[model samples]
Target: MFVLSVLLLIAAVVLFLVGRGKERSASGWKLGAALSAVAGLLAGLFACVHVVSAYEVGVPVAFGKVGSPLTSGVHFKSPFTDVTSFSTRPVDLNLNDDDVVEVRSSQGGVLYADVTIKWAVVPAKAVGLYRLAGSEEAVEERLVLPDSREIIRNVFAKHTSEEGYASAREQIGSEIADLVKERLAPRGIDVTFVNLRNVRPSKKLQEQIDKKIQQEQATERATEASRTATAEAERKRIEAEGVARANKIIERSLSDKVLYNQCLEAYKEAAKAHPVYAVPCGTDSNGTPVIVDGSKSG
Candidate 1:
């Protein structure tokens, strides 16, 4: 469009110059020039306009040198310059089975991790980013992905296979994001978040881990049962001791007269209920009487 407008302006100039030498055709040539000039101006106006979306930032480059960043909305630049847009919103880069990362665990086991990283180009440094990283695609290829792989390896290396598989998986992701951000922030990439979707150890290691977990659970149950049984036994022993102590107190408090009176009262109460078939044995030196069965006397 800019080229066409420039051509139209040149044609208008030629027509106006040619009209100077003509007499009868001069008015027609002037009118044509005026219309062409208006059309050319409109075309040039349209050519220099560029609209940056709300979620993007545009960097203008003229003659291979970067210019001021163009924020969202309409921007005007020389027709010869170029504007490149980079997304300012968070972008997700998934590292899954198609591009899985392999790392070694603290236990020296091989592990596979599927991760995703959310990031964006810092708007303030977008021009610098373009100069250094070229474009958004280039930034991801040259910086985000490689850094993500390296960070994952470094973070997972600090954890055992079981930790990577389950226990510290979230921690590993957070550490990776932090480390990657620290490393890439200076390079104009802002790391927002990282997700470790799946991290798997070898099948053999997984089976061993499952068995170990089951064994630990079983041991915990057994320990709890033993503790309960020991508590019940202690309780019974205490009850027996209390009963024996009460019996001893009763025996020590009773004298010959008290024993005689208690035996008489017991005999009266028993006689009222049924026939008495026991003989009162004489008191011992302890002054506690004993009963002798009449049926066994023979």
Candidate 2:
């Protein structure tokens, strides 16, 4: 504005100096004066127009009223109109991973959680977000950051330390994602990811947890050992029973008379292979191979 005013003053001075005497010719002086004012006004108007950037979208407003949104590139509007440019690209928010959230477990113990989430503004919802939140700072302040934290806290509180730490990790993240999506969907934002970075128990509780796990593992090992020992004892008992039953069957099949008959047959078969001389002493007494009265025996 200052530069334009200076140029206009100079133009006026030059016109005054050259057309001072020509003022007597009213028509000529008026024409010169009119031309000078026209040039100054044009210069001033050019100075008032600030260039709308190509990397941004401008929201033009007349007086205090906002008009239609403008796409990036070059555009012309009234010099006095207000233009507010907004970003259409994605904006990333990085949250800390060590933030602790307090939650009461099913056992009434307090659980601490540390989590991190990476997210961005959805492109299509940028306009609606701008309308509600006014700016990027407002978006985080009013919607994204607060709601994300709320979802995390809500989901964390429902599960115990062990459940939240390992067992229900996927479940918790899914719940958080769902909650965020539902909350922000109306406002034109999408919850891209909800990550559970870490979960820690209290120091005192940690010691107890470690001890419990160890005890459980030891008990399982002992049970397995007992099962193996019992299996071995049962196998041995079955083998012993089988051997005893077989022995009883064999004993029942053998007899003293059978043994005596087998021995007589063996002796008869042996006598046929050798020459023998015998003299019988007594005929009244029953004698079978009695060698005491025999004179010679084979």
Model 1 stretches astray by more than 4 angstroms: 8-37, 207-298
TM-score of 2: 0.61
List the candidates' TM-scores in order. Answer: 0.64, 0.61
What is the per-residue lDDT of model 2 for residues 132-228, given as tens digits with 9 covering 90 to 100?
7777678777887788778777777787778876798888878877888788878866556666666667777778789999999999999999999
**Which candidate comes out best when scored by lDDT?**
1
lDDT of candidates 1 onward, in order? 0.86, 0.68
- Highest TM-score: which candidate? 1
For candidate 1, lDDT tens digit of each residue in 110-225?
Answer: 88899988999988989888987888999899889988898899888899988888888778888887898899899878888888889887777777778989999999999999
